[model samples]
Target: MTTQAEKSQQALILFAHGARDPRWAEPLQRLQQIVSKQVSGDVLVHQAFLELMTPSLPELIAHLVQQQVAAVTVVPIFLGQGGHVRRDLPELITQLSADYPQVRFTLAPAIGEDEQVLKAIADVCIAQL
Candidate 1:
């Protein structure tokens, strides 16, 4: 039986749509830093963009694979299940799976779909009033 410590390395990718302005990425970058610190190197956390940004999803995945990450969890940061999340992401995953059969990629629902997140947002909305 494989030991707990022998489990394959894993990574978390906070996938988001990019904007033309560089500042738009700052919040995600902050999240990446916070998560990395919280994990304390147990699992790597990364940020990647769909367009108008550097380090696209494919690029980040290739880089992580080179570092020998065995599995990856991609969390779409979009507010809803749009075509990009429903259609484009799956196509990208298919290609990535074919390219790197050794790596396992798990796609998560869009962040906005999480109940706890929605509750937090709602609370903050009322607090702002």
Candidate 2:
């Protein structure tokens, strides 16, 4: 009987497909650490890669369940909606939901079109131009 409201107290999990270059993951991990620090609540932050790195989505979700979290939010750290975000992520959520029936989990949209992202890109373009 886990309602959406009850799930709000759960931890958040961000899924990122690791880059071939090791440095690529560093920025995302740093961002995660920053968010974990800034958010004021009983929340847990975790990172999982579709490729490379350790602790895939399933593993992280399993860990969250073991911790008896009220809910788990899976946010895809993707630039845009694609096959992985659109298809694969949904499939993973469905499977995870089935596996952990006691713990509620939610999937957030991809962070593709943020205002800050647009401004950052515009600044880069302006600098180049």
Candidate 3:
């Protein structure tokens, strides 16, 4: 059985590879807004950058810890499972797990790799054509 506090202590982090131009994050921000609205109750939906953007993963995790979030689901927005997703992210999650032993860290596959997402992209392309 989960307590109310425990129920409120879950978060979802949308992780993305940041770019030098802030405009690059606009789509991600919109995605965040969409996800945020879909989530009910106290569940948090946040976006963090791997580089060249504010509030990196570690920083966001620290803040979430402060907010007493007990679990985090990290969803990579990258199109492929490249070095950043396959290597660097796991290393970072391992370190964060060590640092915050109480918190459960879950790494989700890259959004673009999902069949539904791919279908959506194709649908858009088809519509444009």
Candidate 4:
């Protein structure tokens, strides 16, 4: 049973591959904060991990569904579309879609593949030369 307030919430989940070291998630946490501030009211941003961390994708999505978030956009904070991004993520989304029929889920491309991101990396490398 979704409340009227819950029906208006839209969420963005920054999905990343987790590490055993807690410090590894600092950057993503910072990203979540930045995104949260940029978005308008009724939009929420969150972080979820693939492994070696708490609140895996499924868990986060489940919570969001429970909260009655109408839509969710999942952005993979990964460098490339490797096995985890290509194989694992799709499988996870499929299961989540089946579980949360009312909520919409969208997957964004891996962050590194963006032209601006690649150019930034190249600029940094060139600066070191």
lDDT per residue for candidate 1 within 1-129, as digits (tens), equals 965456567999999999999999999999889889898465989999999997899999999887778999999998899999999998999999999999999999999899998998899999999
Candidate 1: Cα lDDT at 107: 97
After superposing candidate 3 on the true structure, give the runs of residues whose Cα lies further than 4 Å from its correct spot: 1-8
The true-versus-predicted C-alpha distance at residue 116 of model 4, in Å, is 1.0
Query: Is candidate 2 or 3 superior in lDDT?
Result: 3
Model 1 misplacement above 4 A = 1-7
Residue pairs clashing in model 2 are none
Top TM-score prediction, candidate number: 3
TM-score of 1: 0.91
Per-model lDDT = 0.91, 0.81, 0.93, 0.91
Q: For each candidate, give its TM-score against the true structure.
A: 0.91, 0.82, 0.92, 0.91
- Higher lDDT: candidate 3 or 4? 3
Instruction: Please list all clashing residue pairs in model 3, or write none if there are none.
Output: none
RMSD, every candidate, angstroms: 3.1, 4.5, 2.4, 2.4
Error of 1 at 69 (Å): 0.5
Q: How far is candidate 4 from the true structure (C-alpha RMSD, Å)?
A: 2.4
Best candidate per lDDT, number?
3
Per-residue lDDT, model 4, residue 75, is 93
- In model 2, the runs with Cα more than 4 Å from the true position are 1-9, 124-129
| Weakest 10 consecutive residues of candidate 2 by summed lDDT | 2-11
